[model samples]
Target chain A: MGYPRLSIAEIREGLRRKQFSCVEITQQHLKRIEEADARLKAFLTVTPESARARAAVLDQALAAGEPLLPLTGVPIAIKDNICTQGVRTTCGSRILSNYVAPYSATAVERLEAAGAVIVGKTNCDEFGMGSSTENSAFGPSRNPFDLERVPGGSSGGSAVAVAAGEAVGAFGSDTGGSVRTPAAFCGVYGLKPTYGRVSRYGLVAYSSSLDTIGPLARSVADLAELLQVIAGHDPRDMTSHGSAPDRYTSGLDAALRNHRVGVPFSLIEEGVEAETRRAIHRALDALERAGCAVEEIALPHLANAIDTYYLIAPCEASSNLARYDGVKYGYRSEHFSNLGEMYQITRAGGFGAEVRRRIMLGTFALSSGYYDAYFLKASKVRTLLIQDFQAAFARVNTILIPTAPTPAFKIGEKTSDPLAMYLTDVFTVPANLVGIPALSVPAGYTPDNLPVAVQLLANQFHEKALLHVAWHLEQAFALKPAALAV
Target chain B: MAITLEEVRHIARLANLQFSEEELQAFIVQFSKILEHIEQLSQVDTQGVEPTYHAVAGKIDRENARSDVIHASFLQEKALMNAPESEEGQFRVPKVIR
Candidate 1:
């Protein structure tokens, strides 16, 4: 197998055995990115020079008999929204197209400290705004499974990079299914850690309360490993939890003899496609066979998650995005009569259509005379959704559901219908709203060969349990990682 | 509730944005549809429920105060590196008043 297709564990083992040098693996993966990224359009920036330099350092360390780091010389991609020191951190928008981050995000710093090679920054919806990468200003990333279909987004490029074997793994932020949806569409493993579990110090804010940086990998083990490296408390991010990080890979192989897996059957009945539903049921059945106690559970307020998310995320987004004025950084308009005109022209010209739509929606909800009716009401419903999850977890260890209502749709299918596109996140938003850990693992393939995935969610800070269940399910299914014919 | 064209324009103004006639017309329809979808929350019985502003609200470290001390920060040149126009190590913008 080529270097690009190797898992992080395999690469680590190979490096220790001297089966391959770090430089060789890094070069091979860089070559794969050079060859495959044109058709896949998965990366916004490829750092070949920096990657080689880092790999050379690691190779010298190995020669000197130094202890190897956890992710030594493993090439990975970061979602463009995560800042990389001296790298252009575009959130897939023209506003920051030329913007170079002065500092690295905390997650990037931790990854590099662990000896990981950052090959490039992957594409996303501008500021993590959309369910599909089609909203990306750079252009949407195409699914490796089918070029006609879109890679689900705003983490689409991250998922595509891992699925196409361009990178061993990738990091993407989840604010309402951005990571998991793309992972499901690309047939990779994605984990959204509980809010506050990971530091968001340099992650460009989308929704402060909901955004989380998580991993997308070819295997569940890699997902857990990457999460271990990046999950910790940071003084810079006050919201970061002070609890010690869990050893996520510790119990990965343990049997789920008495584990409780709740299936929210009622939530999937209406909008989910028949094939997707069957795939989820089959996954649950597999879990049952593996000694998991699969049972039906109720999350009655689940139907209200989408509405609550739409209102609250936009409101927070409107506030977070207000920093992009003409003065300090990012884009500025060339012609404007006054300061007020400059602000208007710069923002109007800098942002894309979907971003503008969201900003406006948020502004309306938070505007005078309507804040109580829309934003506050949505917040109350968010509380109700959290309670529903708490109640379900009281009876079950982890909740299981379909990652997305349907598999990846055609590129332009739902772009014209804003509401329809929003509905794509119905199954995944609850985890974000409640600050719980969630994961999406490949379940099976559809008749058309598209990938379908099942989601597992655990209560807040229960990522180890969630990852344990996912690793077991992943092995039980024994599905092969996605390989592109190209 | 159906949003009026005037309301759309007002919201855009509040957001510090401007749209052409064509874009505004399209937004009118899109906003109407999205707002209609969001209207479902009105049926939820949220009576006596407290709003959750932050996902992990009570867990925030409100008392983790640092001592009053000055530390190193970004240099002036680096801070202004991404600005569209800069002079004398300061971002340049249009005058606020006539």
Candidate 2:
């Protein structure tokens, strides 16, 4: 029998109705990965053995007429950054290439508890530092939409895995558009929850303050389901909020009537490509028709979001990454004379070019002489950005913008120009900086058939409102997943 | 601000990293471009703005603390499983002193 293209809800229902065995569904997805991932390079590691074992146990439970869990028999992929006990969790870098996580992330543990079969760890940028997965030590995950183009990253592999049907759903961490950008490029739904909504205990730290574990799936409902399962307070993470997660799926049925959606017109006027702008405008118009009060608003400080984000994120990254000193864990150099030389050689040899560059940039920013000028200034501007969102949200319930300035570009197009690549995140980073929830829903396809997505931003802990808007838009757009010809 | 090659070298040292002469040359150009881009932030007026260290404001309430019960921790062998080198259940490192 051929593999079925079903949403997470449908898969759950199908299993409940005894239409397919858990092992069968799991095996089909594993086979699909074996076939498609060779070309896509979406997965860094595939755990067929463990997945089969788990599927058999679930199958036995089903045979015994046990009540099914929310994600029973569902095949899911996780971004390599999140730890999975006993599984290799390489954050797309050679530094941790051989490292196996001793403990699973709270999100992963929660997903497994809900009966999700983890198929593999997806690829990502080294330390989640780059815009494209090309910075991955393993290799870039090719965009299923266009093989030559990129699946915008550093969560590119997780997005592609969902888009290409290698996994029914996947989890990716968004530290400034890592999830949303890839979701936009690969034509899927990606949600970056409000910071601290989901525990970050086992996610390999890139930028501790900005990093948030989120979900990517083919539908908004599946995304909501994944978020609801994974989001909650974990005593393991001090930063995780104490409030219980909202029933995200419960708000999916809510109407967008009378909701005010802010459109930062000036933010989109210059940097965004004409096609992407048109698509976003079209989405906004649809929301307006759906009873959202779409209005133009100005967020002048948004122009500097990328500038502020680079400074703060890298600065945090430099400090967070300092633990990899060739002593306790991960890669160490064989040819160093002293401890100091060992550290230098191990880091320089293990990290990729982009990772090293960010480390240098961060080190420079945090260095005693430059701290006040660079890091402090950026932090203050980050406060300004938070104020901008707060002021805008006072008038609007949600803010709408294109997920990226353009659709997926050729793989090598922006690789040489790091600044150009950084600009792709212009629209998505504001939510991260302000600790608000954001969703990237596939809005429309460009003339070339590349997917364009519009982002929905809600104030802190307002994911329900954000998902409500995205659900309505997803229905109106009704974007069919692009066929993976490869 | 233009970063001198010497400054790049200094930053690399601070970051515990080293690069070949060719890599250093490339990094200098790329680093300068990034610095130039970030320099735009200085134009924004941030007077009276407090630096936001955490995205969410306010100290996280430490109430409802999980009772200070010592829970099971990773075994020493499991904890050291990923270490590059281990001796006598301790992570082995290069000599520190002459």
Candidate 3:
């Protein structure tokens, strides 16, 4: 019989028991990448030489009878936006296509220090700005389940990599559902930790206030392990809360005796697919059977999440992306009469259509007469949304919602209209807007076999409880593992 | 409110991006629709509400401020490593002076 998929736990146990050499495991995953990445296009960069070099070091340490590190020899992929020293960080855009970071992100530094073998950088939407990885300048990463369908994105490549078992775990940046949507679509567990749960020191900023680096893995335990390594405060990012991270791995087996799962019923009743609605209901039933009480909760301001997110995200993006002019690094356009034209022409040539559109919308929103009307209005609406979540959390232990409105849609389906694509993130954006920890676990599959995920959100810095409930839901859906088509 | 081509060009310019005539025309339509949709923000009663995007505030300034001492940081060459054009270990830019 074929061996079970290489989960993080399996890799750790295998290495500890001397069942396989670290280099051998690394080579196996790299070979898997060579075969799977051909059609999946899940990776922008594959660091076989470096990953092998690191794995060899682990092997030597094992031969010396030394202890293993937390993620020793575990092949992990980073989203292209997160910098790794000397490795290319493109943010999946032509603007920084050839730019290589001089230093690594704090999260990357932490992951490597914990002994994760860096496999490569995965593709992402340019600047983490799109719901689908189709916004990647290089190309869209196809879903491992169906080549014709998209792996839900911005973090689609990371999700694809984990789903296809090319890497045991991966990191993805979530600005507005970048991590969760892809996780849901790819049928893996994804966690978007509370804002500042992990430092964003080296993440190519899309929207600083909302941006977070998160983990995607095939199992809840692996997701917990990955989060344990990366979650902490850094002096570099003051927004990274100074509190110590909880023992996320230990609480996975917690009984759901106190998990008050609240479902925002009316929020999903309209515009959401009937099948997805059924899946969420099914997940609620599983949680109830597992000894958790489920109730209908109201988050009224959630209806305004899309409009609020599009406005605030772009506003912050317009300011954050202004640094990408020709002067510093990255693409510089040819033929400019003067300095002003150089900046304009270079940006025109460098950014993609969606990027340009968002920057335009952002600039317009923050302009002289419109700031109070558009930007400020969106910010205040953001406060109301947070208040809704706050009020709801007071009544319920955690909130449940669909990770996305539907399963993975076809490539090129929503690309024609940008606004239509924006609606897909309607369910995922509120958690970002509220700065809470949200997780997506596979609930069920559609008739076509695409995955549908249910999301759980906990109050700020409550990743422990959030993951605990997700583990409970994950146990209920244990029979359905991530189906690989690669 | 309808966005005009002139306004679209103005914002694009403000954003330091140049758009062609066709690009600007397409943008005006898309931008107008996005603006119209986000106009729903005006319908909500946000009276006396503070405008905030982050649910939790950043740390207190007293705690956030690092010490005034200078510490190790990127050297000039390291900083300029990725620049499209570098001269004398500094990023070279188009001449700004008239």
Q: Tens-digit lDDT track for model 1 on A136-225?
A: 989999998999898998899999999988899999999999999999999999999999999999999999999999999988899999
TM-score of chain A of 3: 0.98
lDDT of 2 by residue, A1-486 (tens): 233467888888889888988898899899999888899999999999999999999999988989999899999999999999999999999989999999999999999999999999999999887777999999899998889999999999999999888999999999999999999999899999999899999999999989999999988899999998999989999899988889888868677777999998876878788988888888887898789898888887999999999999999999999998888888988998888999999999999989888888899999989999999999999999888888999999999888998899998999889989898899988888999999998987888888888899998899999889888888888776576556
List candidate 3 stretches off by more than 4 Å.
A1-4, B58-61
Candidate 3, A333-388: lDDT as tens digits: 88898988999999999999999999988999999999999999999999999989
> Which scores better on lDDT, 1 or 2?
1
TM-score of 3: 0.98
Model 3, B1-98: lDDT tens digits are 69988888788879999888988778778777888888888999999999996766754245654667888999898899889899987788888888
User: What class would a CAPRI assessor give candidate 2's docking?
Assistant: medium
> Measured against the native two-chain assembly using Cα atoms, what DockQ does each of the candidate structures obtain, in the order listed?
0.78, 0.79, 0.76
lDDT of 2 at A3: 36
Instruction: Report how far off residue A452 is in candidate 1 (Å).
Output: 0.3
**CA-RMSD of model 3:** 1.3
DockQ-superior candidate, 1 or 3: 1
